[model samples]
Target: MELFGTEGYVNVSVKKICDEAGLTQRYFYESFPDRVNLLAAVYQHCVDIARSATIAAATEVIDRAGVADGPVPAAVIPILAEEALGGFINSLVEDPRRARVILIEVVGVAPEIEKLRLGAIHDWADLIAGFASNGRPTTPKQKLAAIGLVGAITQLLVDWQMALTDPINEQAGPDLFQVDSVHEVVTEMFVATYDKIFG
Candidate 1:
């Protein structure tokens, strides 16, 4: 995972991975058939981390709102969005290697890998849709709105990551790296979409 994040999956070889882990090729093959398999595993691991963080953060907000066992009020939607999205974003920002593997390295790796990535995105969208509906069955429109919100957040993170890599973005200021800024933007998007869909 670290290697894929720092050196990139395309550049890293099985030999390097084995060397880093002090394992022989025979042992490595025992676990994974090829490097692509390993990359998929690593990507899943990163997604799990981010997903867990998002859920946990949102749960905390719900608990604090005294709505753990009840429907979440519409008024709390913005705060929920801020903390939930912040959790997902901070989990990656705190570890750029994970961020790279997720947002950059995982792109166009292979058909199977891309499928896995898209599945993860849908999983996140489903999660948000559940939150919006308070665990009720979501309508197709709600699901679509949730997916759109997730896509927007994903693009925002991609752009933020790009700015971090480009020297010219340095002049854009520290807001690029601030989780608060990201949370605010995402929260507004979520709130507006929620109003349109569920009001």
Candidate 2:
């Protein structure tokens, strides 16, 4: 997983993967049937990491804001939005390898991973809907918009990652490496959109 995430899916060979882990090819085969299987494992691993991080962060916000048993206070929404987005974005930013795996490496890898990816997208959309509706039931249009929001977020992250690698984009400034600018803008957008849709 580490090898695939860092070196890229296509560039990582079984032998290289094994060597990176200081293991033999025999050990690799024993664990994973093949490279694609290893990739599937990596993809699932990243998804799990992302899910856990986002859930934990959101749960903290809910608990800390004392919204566990009653209606969430409007005052808590910005905090919730910022913390939740911070959780998701930091999960990727803190480890560029995981970002690479999620934002780049897993595309069209295999049927199994693709299935997981699609499911993850829906799950993220559900999360977004929760934010928009503030625990109220989401209308079909809201649900569709939630999905579109997730897609937009993904594209933004992809572009951000691309900028990190491209020399031309790097010339913009050092702030590009820091995600808070993007995070702040996203949080504001989310708050405004949520209020607009279900204010």
User: What lDDT does candidate 2 reach at residue 23?
Assistant: 97
Q: Tell me the spans in candidate 2 whose CA falls farther than 4 Å from its real position.
A: 167-178
Candidate 2 lands at a TM-score of 0.86
lDDT of 1 by residue, 1-199 (tens): 8799998899999999999999999999999999999999999999999999999999999999999998899889889988898899889989999999999888999999999999988999999998989878899999899999999888778777766775245565445645567668888999999999956
Highest TM-score among the candidates is held by which one?
1
Clashes of each: 0, 0
Query: Could you tell me how far off, in angstroms, the CA of residue 191 lies in candidate 2 after the best superposition?
Result: 1.0
lDDT against the true structure, per candidate, is 0.88, 0.80
Compute the lDDT of residue 61 as modeled in candidate 2.
Answer: 91
Candidate No. with top lDDT: 1
- Model 2 lDDT-worst window of ten: 166-175
For each candidate in turn, the TM-score is 0.93, 0.86
User: In model 1, which residue pairs have backbone atoms overlapping below 3 Å?
Assistant: none
